[model samples]
Target: MQALLQEAASRLHAIEDRLTVRTQIAAAVAAMSIALVSTLAAGAAIISYRHTAALIESSVAGIASSTSARLDRFMATRRQEMKLFTELEPMQRLWQGDPTELRSALEALQRNFDFTWIGFADLNGNVVASTGGLLQGKSVAARPWFKQGLENVVVGDVHEALLLASLLTQRANNEPYRFVDIALPVRDTSGKVIGVLGGHLDWTWASNLIADVQANDGNTDTRLSILSKGGMVLVGPKRETIRYGGDELADMLKVRDGTFRETVDGQQMLTAFHVGNGYRDYQGLNWIVTAS
Candidate 1:
């Protein structure tokens, strides 16, 4: 009877050991499964985050590209028009010594275009013909437009009007008039350079153009800016200087056209930029257009 009882006890101990081993194996498999699921979830989250970031960058870049193209077209069209103006009948009458006809033509241009003033200066830099005859009989010999227009077609940078602004009605806010200069040499039928044709475009046209662009896009959150080659802010939400040398923004400028993430003037933003690729024969001004 004692031997039978000992054998039963040994069998029961063996059964208990097998059950413990199986339980541990089952627990190990469950832990491994949970770990694998967690890793997959983490990987998926990372991929989603990267994709969202890429999409935002691409969208901003697209807006910048579109704005650049529009500006190029605007500039190219104006340049082409200036070229055509040289061939107008009234302009051709210059060789006939008829400054009145040329003045009429320029006046007609002002009616159709946003010209603050347009004039044809003689070789002596005396304004012989002008829009509305405002500056006619005046000597602009010392003006940069008169000097540069003698050689070639020149697109001057924006500047405060010196004498032209005072000749006009004052703005309600008494703001100073700003102008962009465009000039080219005028030649007679003999191909001999006779004089220089120059025009001052009101800066308001540009501001209006940008406003229309932003309104059409319907994206109020996105801000666009135009910068000179040296990074001076030419047009934007606010006229503020952006330091260009030795910063990450400088590195991005070297790329000429791309997207970047950076903090500008204490605001962190994702920005897209496209450098001016001047339209056909226009030889762009190398302005940097940015959308953020």
Candidate 2:
């Protein structure tokens, strides 16, 4: 009986060992399954992170490119405008005295500047003199531009060269010419209107100026012109002759002002208005000059 009891005890011990070993194996398998799932989850998170980072980089690059393009354009335009104004400053200074000096300066201007015509008009709106073509000393007193000056106290009339192109027929060739005119008012120290200082400019100079204004970036063509106080069109291309006193410029007449941009007929024009101080120490009969 003792032997039989010992044998039973050994059998029970073997059975208990086998159960322990199976439990340990099951625990190891469960742990390995959990580790594999966690690894896959980590890899998916990394891929998502990479995708988000790429999108952010692309957005930033696009914005930077757009900003750079706009900035480049603005700087280019400002530079060209500045250069043109500088060229006119010396002529303005010489206009304050000696009608002869003004005439001589105009002669020099015609020779040195890029225009098919350069001339002057007296306070009565008559063409006193001109250089560079047959229009010199020709009477333009009857022209609408002249009439507009007579009515307005102190503002410039800007317009296209075409209005005055009738005077620029070639001597031997049937070639047509173009120009830009800036009809400035001549003033004395007493701030009185004396006469008008006119600039007959070559279209090339202005066109070159517009080209140089890098901000334009070939987006649109630009034209420059001055309007009378009543909003009459003084300068531009493809302009039709309109009656003076009844125009928009006459109705919107205002004080002397300078520098603005507007759109006309699908084109952009940047302009400057040199408003006159009527007849105070003025060097001419038309308008006074005061750094406008």
> lDDT scores for all predictions?
0.81, 0.46
Q: Which 10 successive residues of model 2 have the least lDDT summed? A: 283-292
- Candidate 2 TM-score versus the reference: 0.36
Return the lDDT, model 1, position 111.
85
The regions of model 2 sitting more than 4 angstroms off are 1-102, 111-115, 148-166, 169-175, 209-292
Per residue, candidate 2 scores C-alpha lDDT tens digits across 195-251 of 665554453443344234424423323223323344433333433344234543432
Off by over 4 Å in 1: 1-19, 94-96, 218-220, 237-242, 246-254
How many residue pairs clash per model? 0, 50
lDDT of candidate model 1 versus the reference: 0.81
